[model samples]
Target: MQPDQEVPPRVRPGPLRWIAYAMGAGLPERHRTWVLYDTTTRTWVWRHVVRTFVQLAVPIALVLLLVPGAFWIRAMAALGGLILGMAFSLAYMTEAVENRVKKAGYAPGSAQAVRDLAGREREALDSERRRAAAAKRAVRYRDRRNR
Candidate 1:
């Protein structure tokens, strides 16, 4: 790609923005590319898991701090909340991610669409490579037989 046409780095939201994002807020339109990248990258699942943890963090912390109980009781309460929260978050992982992508000004399912397109492109390239390799093998075998 030409230097002038190079893509800029996706803008990562700051901590506050990230917290808002974990709470289901859509990022600003300028962050559209970042939102797509965040949802469609190879590590997207990990990103989702981390976001889920972030979503649970505040409530869990509050439970540990404010709810009157023994230390073990508070810890147990926080643990239960974390487990239940993660379960729900992961259950709707794809939908939640798609929602974020849509909020970034893209159409619904845009993240999955982008991921699907990339997978197809990769499959095409792999098929081309396999065909080339088979042709090379056939030519090598024919040349050896003739010799």
Candidate 2:
């Protein structure tokens, strides 16, 4: 991305809307940019984890309350289910985010494209800083060796 490329405005959904979104509902058009940013940002993975937990919350509670078992047994079963759900959810997180972007009316692979661009920009900056630091170290090493 160019240094001056205009980022889309980030309009987050309200609490109700966010709950709906976490349950697989598409957000309104006004939040499309936020949707993309949310899926591709540095904290995107953690964001997904939170959403996954939210998605599972009700079911886990229900299992604990309604299942015929001791309290401890119910909790252990819920924990196992939660762990399995998280593992499966993590495996398809990227695809899930992309589906969300598409649901918000973007083309396929849009989230991946944004993530790739951000990664490239980060790498470029890291490379520049590394080169400058390496040059300074080289000069210091040469002076010390001569002395």
Residue-pair clashes per prediction, in order, are 0, 0
The collision pairs in model 1 are none
**CA deviation > 4 Å runs, candidate 2:** 1-8
Estimate every model's Cα lDDT from 0 to 1: 0.90, 0.95
- Please report the candidate that would top TM-score against the real structure: 2
lDDT of 1 by residue, 21-63 (tens): 8788888877778989999997899999998998888999999
Q: Among all windows of ten consecutive residues in candidate 2, which has the lowest summed lDDT?
A: 1-10
Q: Give residue 140's lDDT in candidate 1 (0 to 100).
A: 100
Displacement of residue 58 (Cα, Å) in model 2 is 0.7
